[model samples]
Target chain A: MDSARDEPVLDVRGLRVEYRGDGRSVVGADDVSFSIGAGEVFGLAGESGCGKSTIANAVMRLLKPPAEITAGSIRFQGRDVLALDGRELRAFRWREIAMVFQSAMNSLNPVLTIGEQIGDIFTTHEKLKKRAARERAGELLELVGIDPGRLKAYPHQLSGGMRQRVVIAMAVALRPRLLIMDEPTTALDVVVQQEIMAQIRDLQRELGFSILFITHDMSLMVELSDRMGVMYGGRIVELANAKDLFAKPLHPYTEALMNAFPPLTGPRRELTGLFDAPRTADSCGFHVRCPDDRSDCSANIPDLREVAPGRWVAQSAQGAP
Target chain B: MTHPLLSVRGLTKDFQVGTVFSRRRVRAVDDVSFDLPAGRITALVGESGSGKSTIARCLARLEQPSAGQVLLDGEDVLRTERRRASQVYRRKVQMVFQDPFGSLNPVHRIEHFLARALVVHGHPATGEALRELMTTVGLTEDMLQSYPHELSGGQRQRVAIARALAVRPRLILADEPTSMLDVSVRVGVLNLMRRLREERDIAMLYITHDLGSARYLADTTMVMFAGELVEGGDALAVMDAPAHPYTRLLLSAVPDPERAGSYDPVERARLREAILNPTSCPYGDDGTCSRTEPVRHIVGEDDGQPHWVRCHLRAPASDIARRVLKATDDTEKAETTAA
Candidate 1:
């Protein structure tokens, strides 16, 4: 019941990530900016190579070599995440902001037992004793609806759904303010997906944790999130409340994404075109694919601008957002 | 009304799992039967381990059925010779897979895929005719030279559809074709399949777990539960007025953004529990409901647009059970109250 609107739990401004290799640099996240409040589910949606994941990885400061956070600031609870030292970053990582990777099944160590993996988090962060960590891991397992006794079992022993639950349990072990999940249920069945989603919703209500949910499934994003941001070619093109975004998608790319998903209700309509090839540096990312594409669309790159109250769209040359 | 193009009767598949010494027969697909009318799409929907995929594999001859009859033009394909069956079935039926990226070979150009099928099936005999087939599936002449990796998920699936069409197959079995693509691209693929079915007059077996997409493409839909067709009929009818408890539960669980603001956590939990335990219903194992399996029944005498449902509630004899159990009160009340 915590009001995320009071103050943002996590804030990012002019966030830019770039991949540098062989004396060349490729912009992965270009001036990405978004904020998540406590207990809010903020969705980051885009197609592959759209830089949504880059922003997520950058926030956690987990971007590996070749992928560098070139510019912008990430503030977790008003503290500059970029300013944290190695030891401070390690302590800040999962304790304050935990992440669940795309494939939750693969995220867990196959060789180790679920208990040991979760226990390691407590041992490293909380500096708890072996017995204390094991007990805490059991409690975490129980919290996620897994039998505490099953904590001794290996990841492969559990089904895809159960494995995901285990990953979620581990992620929420420290009761992090913000939990980043990148396509968590993409691998599971719909029935299991519904179950997992419900679990997350229930847990969020109980624990009062915010989420940065990332996926290509816009429908799922709309279902689970409080607010959503649409990404296209390394830019946050549009951001709005989940309901408003689905109701009136502002950006052309956002409109295309909404049109793309087959509605669960109503008459069926054919989607006419596929996403266009990524544009060159000089052109707008969505220029070729946009239904409203004009000569100016190809000539200039658009920037995110607030066209309506609490809704932002990538501004076009015609001054329409 | 035209006769069904493909009719499956008493289809069953049993897999031998565990050690050879103590082998156990797992009935992956039970005695399932359905009719696929020409130019109509029939969806085989179920969760994983529900034998939907097993049935699809059996239909495609990728996996041999332990018991069943696949009648193609009223000829039992299982009884035919291996070589003759392969040749006859290949031209009669073609398959499109879920993973568009995996279905096509990364090393091969998109043209090679369609060209090989065209040559083998004896369609598009001339080079000019082959290129035209490609154009029909919305692929340009330039894309023929592009490799699978170079193309997007939607484009790769289009190529798959094009390859299937090259054989001039009357039936297309698309096993979760759009599930792997981005949501934006998924509709485009589904729309393409729908267009192909309409233009070519091809019967399609569209398999998916996503009910939203199922409602979009299928003319008639089958809801599979624990390897059994628990409910099926007109797609809109089955979706809107889902008869089986499982089907209703599945439909209710679908995340509707409109209703997301007012979701009841308790009701969601109840539905989740019901879905997890498949044997909760009395009709699950009882022979009374299983004997006739309750075929399509006309609720009203108007147009005879009868909707089929496999639940015992639709059976006349189960009136006692319905009143005693009062299973559908909530659903029926909701509908009548809404009206």
Candidate 2:
């Protein structure tokens, strides 16, 4: 477990990404910064178009034209990730940091066998022979708790949960330092989702690899993440251990999001879903939706400052923290 | 008491797949039965291919049931051959599907599409009627003029809901209505559906894979597994303490952020079999428990709701099962509310 504790696996600093074309520009990510410790399951939580997924893409260097990393420094194992291109970028992808794209289960090639798809990773990355790659793929399938006999099964042959597990198996096949999973189980059922997450968690503990798990579901994040970063309107508004964030979210948007979904096993309460998105004129992006919005709160966008030893929050009202 | 708004008995649907020569019968919906009383929300919760959607389709008359009886106001809607009675039955039940984008016509504006449903369904197609329906679902005059593509996912879903309400249906069958929407907008739509129940006093059968949302909106929760009703009771109780082996597995499978509960290694190995194996006792693959067909065990009667688990493992012949069943309710209470 102490394999690499002193140094963070991923160190993203003051990152900025912009989507610009046709005389219009929108901030995809706004000077976001975070770090994932070795073997830590760090969850990034946010809604659609909130810039969480964009950050994942930027980290993987998969951003296309019209969506550029305006200004940012991404370091993996203290090596500059943004500086990599050509042969280095290819080396960095699976061998260093693998990713499970959003709805990756459905993204599987329908015609390809699950084994063939996973085996391709080994063949390309490690230059293993076809038969050897297939053997390694079967081993990976067994590692993810799937039957090795099902290696010949096509994408459509497996259930949604099975398909999702195959993707996870492939992502972890190379045993990368950081595995980025973007809403990995959003498509699966409740029962199967828990099972798949448990599989990932088990694999993480066994292999000791850090994960940047991304999803909008708060409850799911709480179950699996060691620490979490809450994203809103393209900025990481709050960062804390899962317990603190769930119990007491300091940022307004974080608090609002916690109240959005009703608890399954608790006493029922009313949720107003109060407030709207902050106006373009308002300096604070969440001012429009804040139930506790003040004139001073709308004056400036707050800086993400450490409030405690490990907790951080972006709130103008909190007075410099 | 008034009769149930809608009642389904031994509902079953089978789909034919594979080549014509080697055709296989996939039992999408097994012998499922449930009653939808007025103003009460009964949630049919299951994974994909659990037959919850098939039951909903049969109720909406979108698909024909292989064997079953859909009784509305004591009339067998499925058996009804008369056009007038069928029309009345169709008017009483309306469906809202999963994808709001795919459900709406891209070529038509919001107003025209909704207005057309009214005319085709024999409802008043006047401006006042359209305006009233739109207002009920929280839509305004401006949204009506825009195309479906112009509206957001939540707004488009609201439009679908408005169209369902256009016919003033007594029962609304919503099949995964909020799964495709964003997380923030999901609660808003669920809140809207909750408000509609009180406002319209309409019975709704919500089909969903997410139990958290099901617990939020449903008064009664019904757990479906392998195209069979494995458990049914009050939502709170069922979610809190699911009795059936399948229901317990389903509830514990929910990835609760607060509780990363222990996963059953043995169960995880047999996960796919639990969902898609078609036949086999969920408790254990044994001759006694694994019958030729699905069975519903009348576990008990408590409060206004009666808790029942459809598992051969808890058969009536077992003394312990009988004792648990009898402890829930006496014969008198069962007879009084047996309708």
RMSD of each candidate relative to the true structure: 5.6, 5.2
**Candidate closest to the true structure, highest DockQ:** 2
How big is the RMSD of model 2? 5.2
Which one is best on lDDT?
A: 2
State interface RMSD in Å for all models: 2.6, 2.1
The DockQ score of candidate 2 comes to 0.56
Model 2 lDDT at residue A228: 96
Tens-digit lDDT track of model 2 for A227-278: 9999987888899998889888887788777777667778766676634444
Q: Which ten residues in a row have the lowest lDDT in candidate 2 chain B?
A: B285-294
Query: Per-residue CA lDDT of candidate 1, range A1-321, in tens?
Result: 245457789999998898999988888989888888878899999887888889889999889989998889999888999999998988898889999998877878899999899999899889999999999999998888889999889998898989999999889989898999999998777777887898898789999899999998787899998899999888888899988998888778887776665667776665554465665668765677666645565755577778778898877647654
Estimate TM-scores for all models: 0.86, 0.90
Q: Which stretches of candidate 1 lie over 4 Å from their true place?
A: A1-7, A20-25, A123-132, A285-298, A307-309, A316-321, B1-3, B19-24, B81-85, B122-126, B261-305, B317-339
Question: What is the TM-score of candidate 2?
Answer: 0.90
What's the lDDT of the predicted structure labeled candidate 1?
0.80
